[model samples]
Target: MILPCFLFTSLFMVKLSQRAWNNVIIVSMLALIMLFNLSSNFLNDDSDAPAFSTLIPQGLLISTIEFSNAKVERVGQGWRIESKLSVSKDLQGLLDVWQSVEVSPFEENLQWGDSQPKVTVWFIGQAEPIEYYFLILADKTLVKLGQQTYQLVNVNYQTLIPTE
Candidate 1:
């Protein structure tokens, strides 16, 4: 609607050659595309928080290749690491690093920055897997459900390796 009015005004104000009009059209189209692209970045980052279901009532299969590079699973007795040894206090403490994993929403910017090796956890009965991502150099924690949305979760890296 406004385009026609603006075009009409531009046409009366300036008389240009056919080639110039074509160039103008191309430039305007490019500008619109650029505007949409820029706005989409904001739209994606401003999306509502992910809706993470309640904690799995059964158990969880926690796996990661990051700091500890440990693979843990809930066994008949207790947590098992690397599918062999039982979860010791040290190992248990390492596992506790992710215990505060929550699916709460984020109000501010939640942009997915530089990717890192994520700690993937499989909650029994959950359709989506919770993947925790963070930079070892940085202190923030980012999480994503499956492949859809990502959010900055409230978590920090703590040294669970007890001094022996």
Candidate 2:
């Protein structure tokens, strides 16, 4: 402990040249900059966050999806649509859109209209069906699941719901 103290005092006693002191300052500044950058890289990491959020949970096999007027079901390897209203021209394509659609969380609270359509979805092995409500506006399509609402990233209301 005495030797360490002596060495520490000797280091300060020996006067460094002005150029050497400048070099030391530059090196210390570079080290501080490197440390700051490394800390920022670790602090701002977002690897856990997904790039895009899906409307449905990943790998969830939907057994039945009931729209406002139509009910679509999975039969064997294909899908069956039973409806009293107008059916989509490509029912499979519509199913694909629902299955693969991505959504982002709505930032602001919106006052939804009274004429919102309800969509009920039942997954395999799930006892309770998930209910979703749609607030289709002139420009955007919003889906409310439970209390949170999300905006459909790519699909519009007309594509999912067809009318004559």
Query: Could you say which candidate leads in lDDT?
Result: 2
**Candidate 2 regions with alpha-carbon error over 4 angstroms:** 1-52, 86-88, 162-164
Candidate 2, 1-164: lDDT as tens digits = 69857865775788999997788679869978999999999999989884448877787788998887788889988888888876646767777888888899887898876579988999998999888889888888999887888999899867776344
Clashing pairs in 2: none
Worst 10 residues of 2 by lDDT: 155-164
Clash pairs, candidate 1, are none
- The TM-score of candidate 2 is 0.64
After superposition on all CA atoms, what RMSD does each candidate show versus the true structure? Answer: 14.7, 11.8
lDDT of 1 by residue, 22-130 (tens): 9988987998899899999988893464345322212555533223455666666456566333434455665565554444443444556655555556765567665
Q: Please state the error at residue 161 of candidate 2 in Å.
A: 2.7
* lDDT (0 to 1) per candidate: 0.53, 0.81
Top-TM-score structure, candidate number = 2
